[model samples]
Target: MELKPIKTRKIYEEIVEQIRELVVRGELKPGDKLPSERDLVERLKVSRASIREALSALEMMGLLEVRSGEGTFMRRLKPESVIAPLAWMLSIEKGTVQELLEVRKILEVQAAKLAAQRAQADDLRELEDALENMRQEIVNPELGGEKADLQFHYAITRATDNKILILIMDAISDMMQQMLKTSREKLYQGKYTPNILYSEHAQIYEAIKRKDPKQASEYILEHLSGVEEELNSHIE
Candidate 1:
């Protein structure tokens, strides 16, 4: 490999590009640790600060992970990481909330259907546990109900048994968790009765338990539709 001298004013970016190129060419494979900061500085003929900045940028891009004393390592890239930045940016734009709701509806409606068809006994038990947790947290003020709500949906996703679907769901899970908290808070404020939410979730669980894909899909879609309506009405 040619150790080219850093000649650009944007030295940090140049460093980032070179390392990125190495990664692309498989010179830096996933889980491979990089040379230390001092070694990188010497090899790239750039300041230590520039190397640090490049490493930081790579970390933010989900391409590398830095351990406090273990050095930086290339991460096994996921498609979700590539789309995450765009997904986050869209989340902040006007009209994006509805878009998120729509995406949630699509992914979850199908997940419900798949779970209905494929859920094993353990998967059904997980859903039951999540629902019971939500019921017990009905009066909780610390968002416990919301956490259970997220878990209920996650259990459904797990039942789908599709790795790609699971990855996509996991990718958007953080944002969805925040949204679920806002939704539970609104429900607590009496925007909608808590019983309605509980009953609907129970219906979803029952549909999956009975292996009724159609009912499962319908129940979940109806649940999402109600949430979207309430959220839109309360937003502004």
Candidate 2:
């Protein structure tokens, strides 16, 4: 509820920054209603147009939800919603798919290690559910397990309990999913069978469940490296 007056020429960007800072400081949270435009203008000593522009940008960033006649409220952040804008830009970038996997190896390997150390019972349940879903997908190829694969990784990030790490995962989730879908298709067409993929995931899950951080990290790295190798083969 602390609204400072804006003195900068880029008034809207300043507004966005302040609001974002509030969020980072835990002042604003999901479902909290923002001040009215009139209220914001007066509080920030800015024009209504500046307030509107900032609000629009925040909405686009998936940070706010503007319901009809209900004012604007802080949105519950979802990986897909938060990263949609960034995903669009990354989708057009050269060699982004390869880069995405490289980033994934870095993030996910550490995430697996942390998850092995910190995962709670609820986190274990989610990981198990995702693994079960993967098994089901393998049994019935029509079901498609790509979603389960993504969910498993997301559960690992959640288990880490690091907000910044979780946010970075959200930022890349869309592109990650696209990469998974394409890579899996190419891999399946090659020597990599669906069962092989499922086995690799299962091994990682077992390592985490055993609370063996070293094993979990190793398993995940090996799995990711294999996927990268397969994808490279197709590209080459």
Candidate 3:
């Protein structure tokens, strides 16, 4: 309700930023209806067109929902919805593949450690299932095992039971999948075999299953660091 007038070339982006800031500040909450376009126009000193554009963008980002006759209401923000635009942009940026791997190392190493400490029986079962799927996919020439490999990593994050970490994982899922596929292809072309990949994942799983956080972290780091080295060698 304390909106400011827009004074920029990109009026719509500014409007979106202001609205997003309001949401971040806990002023506008989920299920709260936004002011009408005419009211927003008066408040932001922007044209109705700009307001509409901003609102439309927010809707597309899953931040707002427009009812047929009930105006626009803020949607419950999901981690994936909030960070999806960043994922899309990163997907298009050049020379980010290595950076993505770096991020994976940071997030996944800690994920493995926390999973060892916090994983429940269900979490262990999920990890085991993913590992078994990876083992089965090793002999399936067409399947490539990338999906199972990604699932294995996702299961580890779920075991951690940390919502923010899980949110970050969900947000970068597409990029992660692409990274897996690309790196696997590169490694397979050289000396890495599907069985070798399966073994690495199995070791990580065993470490987590034993509730050995240190061993789990070491195994995961070793696996990822090797892959990172392989990726860098190809890139260079």
Worst 10 residues of 3 by lDDT: 86-95
In candidate 2, what are the lDDT values of residues 1-236, reduced to their tens digit? Answer: 79898989988878987987898799999999999998998899999999998899888878899999999999998865655444434544536667878998989999999999999999999999998999898779998778999999999999999887887887777777777787778989887887998899889889999999999999999999998888889889
Candidate 1: the clashing residue pairs are none
CA lDDT of each prediction against the hidden true structure: 0.82, 0.86, 0.86
Task: Tell me the tens digit of each residue's lDDT in model 3 across 1-236.
Answer: 79998989989888988988898799999999999999999999999999998888778778899999889999987767877545534554534777888898899999999999999999999998998888787667687788888899999999999988887888788878887887788888765788888899999999998999999999999998888787778888
TM-score of 1: 0.68
Every model's Cα RMSD, please?
6.1, 6.1, 3.2
Arranged by TM-score with the best first, the candidates are 3, 1, 2
Provide the global lDDT of candidate 2 against the true structure.
Answer: 0.86
Q: Per-residue lDDT of 82-196 in model 1, one digit per residue for the tens? A: 5444444344443455777899998999999999999999999999999888787667645466778889999999999987788777777777888787677665565556567
State residue 182's C-alpha deviation in candidate 1, in Å: 2.0
- TM-score, per-candidate, Cα-based: 0.68, 0.67, 0.82
lDDT of 1 at 56: 83
